[model samples]
Target: DAGITQSPRHKVTETGTPVTLRCHQTENHRYMYWYRQDPGHGLRLIHYSYGVKDTDKGEVSDGYSVSRSKTEDFLLTLESATSSQTSVYFCAISEGLAGGTQYFGPGTRLLVL
Candidate 1:
C-alpha cells in the first residue's frame, strides 16, 4: 500500500488488559480500516472510517473501537485484550477502488498472556 503504518510491530499483553494500536497513512485516502488476520479467520474487518469522525462497525468490531479524526491517521483500540484476540493486526485503506480492493499495512503481532 502507498500509505500505511502500524505501530508496535510486536506486542505481548496479559489477558483483560487494554491495548491500542496506531495506523497511519500518508495517501490522504478517504477510507481507512482495521483488520485482524488469523489462521482460520483470514482477514476480518474490525472497523472502518469513511471520513473524519465518520466510522462504522464491521463484522468483528466487538471489543474494538476506532477513531479517524484526520485524513492521514486512523486508530484501533482493544478495550480488553484477550487470548482470542491474539493475531496479526493490519491497517488498510481503500484508494477508492471498486470491488472492495484494499491496501494493507505490514501488521502488528499481538500476544495475550
Candidate 2:
C-alpha cells in the first residue's frame, strides 16, 4: 500500500560535495515534485516534472536539479552540497496540475556539514 518512497532516508555530507536523492512512486501519477523543508521558509519547491524527461525549475532551484526518466522515478541532485542546503527533502506526486491532490513521501533528512 505504499504510494511513494524516498531512498537514503538519511544522509550526511560535507560542503562542496555532490549529493543525489532518489524518489520512487507506485501511484503512476503524471506529475512529480521535489521540495525542501526548513524551519522558517516552510516547504519550498526545488523542481518538478510534468512528464517523463520534461522537468522545470521551481522558485528555489538555484543549486538543485531534477530529472525524471520514467513515470514512476524522479531524482534530485545537488550540484554541490552546502550548509544552507541541509534540510528535509520531500517527494510529491499528483495526477494533474489544476486540482490534483499531492501525496508526499516520508522525506529524506540531509545534513551538510
Candidate 3:
C-alpha cells in the first residue's frame, strides 16, 4: 500500500447528502491526484495537489473540491452527492508531473442513490 490510505472504502448515500473521501500517503511524493472511474468514462481526473496547500482543478471538478494541508494527506469532498457521482475513486501518487510512474491506491467505491 506504500503507506497510502483511503477512508470508508465502500459507501452508500442519498443523492442530496454531502460526502467526503480521504487519501493519505506516507511516501511524501510531490504530486497527488484524485480520479474517478466509471463505465464509460474510464478514468477521469477530478483534482490534484502538487504541494501542501497548492491544489488545482481537473476536467471533472465541477462538483468537487480538494484540500491538502500537509505532505501526507489529501482530502476530496462532494458538496452534494448525486447518482452520477457513483463510481470508483482512486488516489495516485507520483514523484514528478511528467515521465514518472504514478502509483495508485486501492479505490473507494461510492454509490449515491
Candidate 4:
C-alpha cells in the first residue's frame, strides 16, 4: 500500500548469464534494501541504499550489486547468473530499520540451470 514494485515476477535462465532486477517505489522512503530468501537463511540482506547515490553492500552482496540513482528507483544486478543464485529476491523500503516497518515488493523468482 505504501508504494513498491518488482519487475520480472518470474524468470528462468541458464547458468552463467546476467540478470538485472528492478525495484520502484512511490513513497520516497529514505532507505531501500534488497534481500534474497532461501530455505535456511530466511531473508538475507544483499544490498541497501540510504539515499540517492549513497549505497552499501550487505551480507549477501558477493554475487550481486545495487544502485540507487533516484529516490523512487533502485536496481539490482547479478554480474553472472549461477545455479546457486537461484532464489527469490525481494525489495523493501522503510523510513529506517529501527522502526521495524518495511514495505516489500511482490518479489522476483529467478532460476538458473
Which is the leading candidate under lDDT?
A: 2
Give the C-alpha lDDT of model 3.
0.91
- The superposed Cα distance between candidate 1 and the true structure at residue 23, in angstroms, equals 0.4
Model 2 lDDT per residue over 5-64, tens place: 999999999999999999999988999999999998999998999999999888799999
TM-scores for candidates 1 onward, in order:
0.93, 0.95, 0.95, 0.94
User: lDDT of candidate 1?
Assistant: 0.89
In candidate 4, stretches whose alpha carbon ends up further than 4 angstroms from where it belongs are 97-99
Cα lDDT tens digits for candidate 4, 1-113: 88899998999988888899999999979999999999988999999999999999888899898888899999999999999999999999998762389889999999999
Backbone atom clashes (below 3 Å) for every candidate: 0, 0, 0, 0
Could you tell me which 10 consecutive residues in candidate 3 have the lowest summed lDDT? 94-103
Q: Return the candidate ranking by lDDT, descending.
A: 2, 4, 3, 1
lDDT of 3 by residue, 1-113 (tens): 57788887999999999999999899989899999999977999999988999999988999999999999999999999999999999998998873369989899999999
Q: What C-alpha lDDT values do all the predictions have?
A: 0.89, 0.92, 0.91, 0.91
Off by over 4 Å in 3: none
Question: In candidate 4, which residue pairs clash?
Answer: none
